[model samples]
Target chain A: MDYALNDFLMFTPEVYLRLFERTHLALEPWFWAVPVAWLVMALLLWRAPPRARRLVPVAMAAGWGLTAAIFMLQFYAPINWPVGPFAWLFALEALLLVLLALRVPPVGIGPVVLICWVAVLLALSLMTALEAGTWQALALPGVTPDMTAVTTAVLLMAWPRRWRWGLLMIPLLWCGFSVLVLWALKLWWPLIVPAAGVLIILIATFWPTSESPDNA
Target chain B: MRLPIRRRHFLLGLAATGVAVRWPRTLAGQHESPITRAIPSTGERLPVIGMGTWRTFNVGNDPVLLDERARVLELFFHSGGRLVDASPMYGSAESVVGELVERLDRSDDLFAATKVWTRDERDTRAAVAESEALWGVGRFDLMQVHNLLGWEGHLETLQAMKAEGRLRYIGVTTSHGRRHEELERIMTREPLDFVQLTYNIADREAEARLLPLAREKGIAVIANRPFQGGRLFDRVRSQPLPGWAGDAGVSGWADFFLRFIVSHPAMTCAIPATTQLAHMRENMDALYGQLPDETQRQRMINDFQEI
Candidate 1:
């Protein structure tokens, strides 16, 4: 049986909420899935990988910790910003992913661009948060996270400059997909997982390791 | 007579049926309310209380996160729910929904509904292609003009796609307060299978024109924001949930609001956004109880508005 501790928490909160007729939106509520997946990915990565493996988990942890802290602030005190807390927190986490990806070999201009994007995102978020007298006023802003690019960039920057240039092809694939999906769906949230999964697969598939699956 | 050929073509959707309609989840133990509507363009019996993807399911670009979301969907299907509605406006909701269906290896249980929100014909076509790609389905049960954006451009493209046999249903959507008269005119003009609009306890304006017109026009209604931006929850705050609500099988504000909308003869479903999984099950569960008759409905209206 899947021990649904999150479900239990989510489900259990209702027992008391039922007493009050009000719709109790549990602010600062945890989405057990985020941590659940994070740790799972971290465990897998720690076992695999170059020296960056150590840095990856640490950056992810810091990213999550800061994101959590921001959420806590937003939950207790509302902010008046253009974006939601979720989006801002997500950008922060994406920043960590860029940092973590850097520790692994093959850090490239893509990571730099990403870090820059995060910087801009942070600046914008900071402006919004500061403007909002209460932090709760901030909203989730628009930030599309495409891991294909980062993964492709990693492959490209890995040097040994052979036909491995085909590596960047993966992100090109995701880019083509994002164009269709974003245009068709009019939203970016659905791409989150398949893209991440593809990134993980590419990371494992291309790594200069014994476990790499042969394409041929 | 022409419809038979079309129906045959659709039934030739043997591929789709094999892929789309999983055997009902509730067939064994539970008794379900038997209210089915024929797709006017082609006679298909779709259960009215369909599922919607918005806040809860849309977590774009995160695969591992999606794996966990799988259970929410498992519950939806296991509970005998079908007819999933999504749109581009909802931000990856459709894509995430599509991904989940694929992961479940159970596209057979879905009545996929999605929408386009672009103005240009190129953009509209691009959107439809993306919808198909993200969801991993070759066709859609319904594709609507999200909030009526560039609807003229998108509607023409949808009409063309329908003619080409890519989509079975063409529809439109609008949210939160609108020029109902204009919406009515659009509904009258379009050969729409469904039209999604905001209708809730607080936003009952749809009742006056849009809904009556939908009933007369034979267009399906999808109620959105059934809680009216969570205000209904606030209004019902601290007050005791009426014992009668419990009798209707509603456990929380989400269900109470959803049931109220679906209880209407015109509504196909009420799609509420929730990020958490429990909310998904709770909202879909509202389908189990007795639909409020006119008397009880009016009583619900009176009490709700008074509050």
Candidate 2:
């Protein structure tokens, strides 16, 4: 296992990723691109079908978490191969996307995908923290799965089931608290994004649900 | 042998000759010809601190990256920068710079220059048109036969463009150690506005023939590979800045290195690539002062080797 871990982390691709990133610092503009990409995704989500709205976040969270896990696994630990429970869940999400496209989840499977993908991301976040000795770099938005999963999950979980907005407010509060922690750490734009998401969600909630599903 | 735009690729380098009309005085000798000049091809003066669109800038239009770089170019304009050189070989540099400058609403500030790399006249026209479409410019200020690839055919087209005013000037470029002989032969025969070649304290061969020929022809020279494909940087870094380097008004090793190229009478500006704003500012600073004289240039060479 030690042999496997050493060689795996020390592989050329891992070294290349580290060097390419360090050499270019291409991520510097992520301060702007992240927000811009968000605006694009948000615009994309605003007009997409309920199923697309639901699956998009779920797919995003799953993809983001899986990519993060892959990075940490390649860097800190070794995942050796790609067959596991999360792999199975991702397969299930893929299947769900097809179903959602067929209009299967009307209230939106935003909750369903959120629950599955966020669990995976949090698990990876935990493993990455355990392996790296510190979570300093891993606490940022992309470093974890889509936090939009949490927001969409909150709305989906709270609304149709008649649960008060308070029930969903727990994760919302956690999101808020994480931003505060990040800010105190002088995390800069890393914390600013989730904080902005908080404002957008608060504003979005006051918005009426007057537009029901056209074909629902 | 085939420097086809489809396969023949090269990184674009920055040059001088703008900022005459834009900002306040300081650049008293800024060349007017955008790239470099032979003699009296003079018109509106070109800025010496122009942008080179290569590597990542070669990627065809991504509105997001374009928007960010637009601000960078806007900053470039505010600082009185003018030349922007691109090539069909540089993927989409010509196009992206065009779209970028256009969107920034400051396309007029650009002294646009590009290259023809393909082997056939038909491919040459197609590539030039693509560059025109990419940048939305009707004509290019300078169009060179890139790398001397298909030089016979492309040079004919460039000659025609000159006659029709589709191009303002013509030039040629080549790199690496092997091409020096072929590059030399082309230099002796061609009427070129600018001859772009590799020159640094490290690669001293070009100084023997190319530089002298350019001086004799009255052709302007563009020095590329000022850092030897960035290998020069790796060699001298982490060492203390030479004591006398500061006496030259150089703030960093970049100016220390590039000014050596600029100081040569046979040379024009040397273009070095940097995405970092700090590095860009340092590079632009090289053009602001008097270049090194012969004795100082020799010392610059001796110091570089010692490091």
Candidate 3:
């Protein structure tokens, strides 16, 4: 009936890292191309024509959906039941991204926001390679949960002021959840740095002055 | 050869009286007295050592891991294990146990115990049914309210189910020594047949109140987290088990740890889960041989503390 305290502490850093390694191995040649594609997409977001800029949310939706479908629902949910609901949350986040993408392409994301996204992507990739051992086993940026979280955070900040806060909910909530998990599992340094970005956004922003569509 | 000799005598008895006399002494060691304890409510005897399916048995639809766990169950039953405890919270564990028991055709001997852990009365009813289906047991031997969640609502349903003969016993559980005051309150008020709680030698908080309360209330106690989810092993991994542990017939630290639990007079069962065959064998080995007396139980506590 009751869980042993240790049950909550299962999947130490080594075990969690192995999931990424196995996922990478399973995903293969297509997986190898994901990081390159992610880099190209981030660069395009900066100076791409409005037509190309519109594709950002579409690509971000695919990232969230893939992380949910492949990483969370398929791999992680079996061992960690808490992730089962989270898989659906990620899918819903993807749906939200689709809705946003269909709307007009907003004023381009600020240079500062794009820089933070790049930092999150690089930091996560470096940490995955460092901790998991072998750069070859690194998680694809934008295709893994940490990267998806960062991408969502950036996309939220770039949205029209009305849509930004509601859209940021999932990624911010995930940041808090990941902090607890990563802290408990003692995967400290990488999580600590990337998590600071969320803190910065929290400091700079206030609660929305106008209600979102939920009120409508 | 032994069976043939017994059969010849039985046949002679049957030929004389036209009634077959069953051989009482056919398997000598098989009758070696197993350590068992009395259930407080019905005075039924149950083996003191039981199996827990916590994180250890949560493998989901993996045939290879299922086979590995099945072999562990084989060793458990082979060593006189009877009670196998599980819950819905232990992801895929109930279904895994159900599949293993059905595949091995050993459900008859298993004492199935699980819990309902939802928030509402309707959800609790649905959860129990889901567990029954997952475990493939038409009825559970014992059903407990997990972590005392929705205890009032689920306890009502469990009591009703027990009266209707759907479950053999009703109880509640908690771990990490959380909600002890609330648990004690319920224990005093409810007509529970069992109370599962964390009661390892390392975490002996239950000894102060819950164990004594169970004794006074005539409620059977199922001790969980007996090894503290391998924390005890981790503690003594480097240090040598005290030489005096041999006096209590402890071949390894697992036996030392488990025997310390089952030896407690109030402990009806101690469920320790392990995925490895050797560890399961080690756990079951504690079931046989000598258990420690009060003096020795204290000695174990002192020794563990020293380590």
Q: What is the interface RMSD of each candidate, in Å?
A: 15.0, 15.1, 5.0
Best by DockQ: 3
> What lDDT does candidate 3 reach at residue B152?
93
Model 2 interface CAPRI class:
incorrect
Candidate 2: where are CA atoms >4 Å away?
A1-216, B1-45
lDDT of 3 by residue, A1-216 (tens): 345434675334554565676567667768967777676676766667666766778888888888888878776777677888988999998898888878755445445767876776576667767765677546564567776776566555555566776677887777777777777666765475348647744732553342223212
TM-score of chain B of each: 0.84, 0.82, 0.89
lDDT of 3 at A15: 44
lDDT digits (tens) for residues A65-174 of candidate 1: 44434432332112111224433444454455455455443322234544554443334333222332334322222111233243323323332333334434434454
Deviation in angstroms for A126 in model 1?
15
Which has the higher TM-score value, candidate number 1 or candidate number 3? 3
Candidate 3 local lDDT, residue A37: 68
Name model 1 segments beyond 4 Å from true. A1-216, B1-29, B33-35, B248-250
Cα shift from native, residue A49, model 3 (Å): 3.0
Give the candidates in order of TM-score, highest first.
3, 1, 2
Clashes of each: 32, 11, 0
Q: Which of the two, 1 or 2, has more TM-score?
A: 1
User: Candidate 2 on B158-247: residue-level lDDT in tens?
Assistant: 878788888887888876554778878777887777777777778878888888888887777777667675567889879877888887
